[model samples]
Target: MRIPESFFVIYQPKYTVPCVFDLNERGTFPNHPSVTGTWGFRVLADTDLKASVQFAHLVHRPGKDPQTGKAYEWMVEETSIDLDDQLTLDSAAVEKKITDSEIRSALMDAFNEWHDNFVPMKKKKVDIEELKQKLGNVVDECKERIRKELVRKNQHWVSSNIPRRIHDFKYGLYNHVKERLYQEYQSNGGEDSEPNLLKKIALFNRVLDNFDHEDLMKPDGTVWRNEDEIWQCWIGFAGSEDEAYRICRTMDAVFKDLELDEVG
Candidate 1:
């Protein structure tokens, strides 16, 4: 009942801040002040739990407006959150509670069901004709519409007079071509063109994959590169009555590895 590590969504949280410096009153820079506030952690356990909290701070800055040479005031806002507390949560408790063998088994079962339901095969035929009919003329057309909509919705990233809508349309067109090729190969005798078809499918799939947000933060109090590492740690400590003590040891190791002070 072991699950492929990728089946689970591992959470990781990261903090970012500017470096600070102390300067001599004589206009000469003197020493480097400690730079703090950046760290990352992965949530190995409790997929359902919300682990991090965000806090914000505000500031005022002075500036001048170009139109009116007179001095004008401006406001600059600064924000920060304290992650150190949650980042030190006991890892053993997380592993024991979240990534236990039973949870892994359940995840595998769910993943298998999802994979079987989605992947194309001979015996389990996907209703291409129905999909086409429901989605106007071409199956590619439907995918294109979805892709364009996604890009349009994220128009903040686009610039230039070309119109953000045009960019999305072009992206959608390219994807449509790739999907059409895939559908054609699948409908015709798949053996000769199957590999090429799969390549095209992968290409279009990659485009669709780009719609996810890149800045998502993981839950607080966990630190592992990936889900597999988290699961391995969990499996090592499962089924023990002294779960808290075991968790403390695991946390100690994690902190040492990250060069962080041990949390009590």
Candidate 2:
């Protein structure tokens, strides 16, 4: 008896119609592309099979008959296999054979063998190098902003009377950027590589630059402090200090550099 269609899973290539595989009494299966593409099917369950099997590939020639005006399928490839010669299958043996590296690799090889025969070739090529350069530029810009707008501001914390206030501003900015990077990493297949880190840094920097007092106020006239509000004092503060402190940080090296620049 033929294996039930439900017992097989077709590993059809993306953007291609499924190739039909139908078994007959003689163990011969003739396959043709729906339009013209390739696919491989795998048997998920063990079943009784014929002693011999033959596979044939058919192609639908593009041009139509001048008189009949109908396309025709032409047999282009053929192969065969004898199951009895290959093995006597027990559950363990079948599982081992299917999982074997050679067999697994062959499955992918067969799937990729099919290609578009009818379509004309005129696909636009992507400039991968150009895209890479642009991405590098954006990351570099983010790094520059981090140094100038964020790290450089550490000078204020060095001399300020209220040290903890400035410390939270620095700490808050660190957490904010870190949180942004973590979120981006989770969405990006968990790769915390330098490039991805830089991208997220650039993104959070923009978020900080756009912070506003009007967006953070509550109905009771108190400033709402959550992820959005990076610093304290939503009402009395009338300058960019709060926003800068919450969004950026100062380091010892940056503070030293600021003093030197001032002396010069």
Candidate 3:
């Protein structure tokens, strides 16, 4: 009868500990002199548990060497629980996987929705009226205050230092209008008041005028004027914060005139 071979079980407290052995007959047992390489088993540990009973075994194999026909291998034994048990995964690890998968699925769905539904819808609808309304809204909110102020101050004929001065002017005018709105809001019992309505109406009128002016300036539009020095000056003066404030003040005065006209 053949006697059963006694297997030596090596116990490593840390799973990161590498198992080194030479498959070649010429290499030593513990330290392989013929082949110099390292192999380790990865251990996924439950961060909450300090004991050895909370580690999951994962096998790691490095790239094979062409010269030595020997391949490295190591066994990872389940320390916390049986490998067959799905409950071996801690709550944290399961939660992380679930969260990661959810994020990935959401991103994919968003991409597909944009590609399939949104892009196609964009090409189908070509509403010029809606587009005009949107453009009008932007121009009214952004360009109206600057235009009114420039016109009121009679600064339309001055030269502009930079071509982008109109952009700066628009920003300045927006801030001025916003501050006035805030002040009106505060004075009229906060957001719920007649003064807020008046403020909105005034702002709307200003925006409308701006839209009209822009349309007039366009070549194909009704009120086309040659690019003049006054227009340049208006843009330049409006670009400066101090000049922009002056222009807004002039616009406020013009609104006061309108209020008087309505009363008259």
Better of 1 and 3 by lDDT: 3
Which parts of model 3 are misplaced by more than 4 Å?
1-210, 213-235
**Higher-lDDT candidate among 1 and 2?**
2
Q: Show where candidate 2 strays beyond 4 Å.
A: 1-16, 22-33, 39-54, 60-79, 85-264
Q: Residue by residue across 159-201, what tens digits does model 2's lDDT show?
A: 2323443445446644444445444444534444544334333
User: What TM-score would every model get versus the actual structure?
Assistant: 0.18, 0.18, 0.16
Tens digits of lDDT, candidate 1, 1-264: 121232221222232443211111121112222335211122221222222211111112345545555443322222212222222333344344343455435433443354344333454564544432332333333333433554443223222222434445347543434444434444433333434333323323322222343432222322333433333332222212133233334333433544442242
Q: Which scores better on lDDT, 2 or 3?
A: 2
Prediction 3 global C-alpha lDDT: 0.34
Task: Give lDDT per model, in order.
Answer: 0.32, 0.35, 0.34
Better of 2 and 3 by TM-score: 2
The number of clashing residue pairs in each candidate reads 4, 1, 6
Q: Which ten residues in a row have the lowest lDDT in candidate 2?
A: 230-239
Report lDDT (Cα) of residue 154, candidate 2: 30
What residue pairs are clashing in model 1? 12-218, 13-218, 42-222, 92-247
* TM-score of candidate 2 relative to the true fold: 0.18
Report lDDT (Cα) of residue 25, candidate 3: 25
Model 3: colliding residue pairs: 156-230, 156-231, 157-229, 157-230, 158-230, 158-233
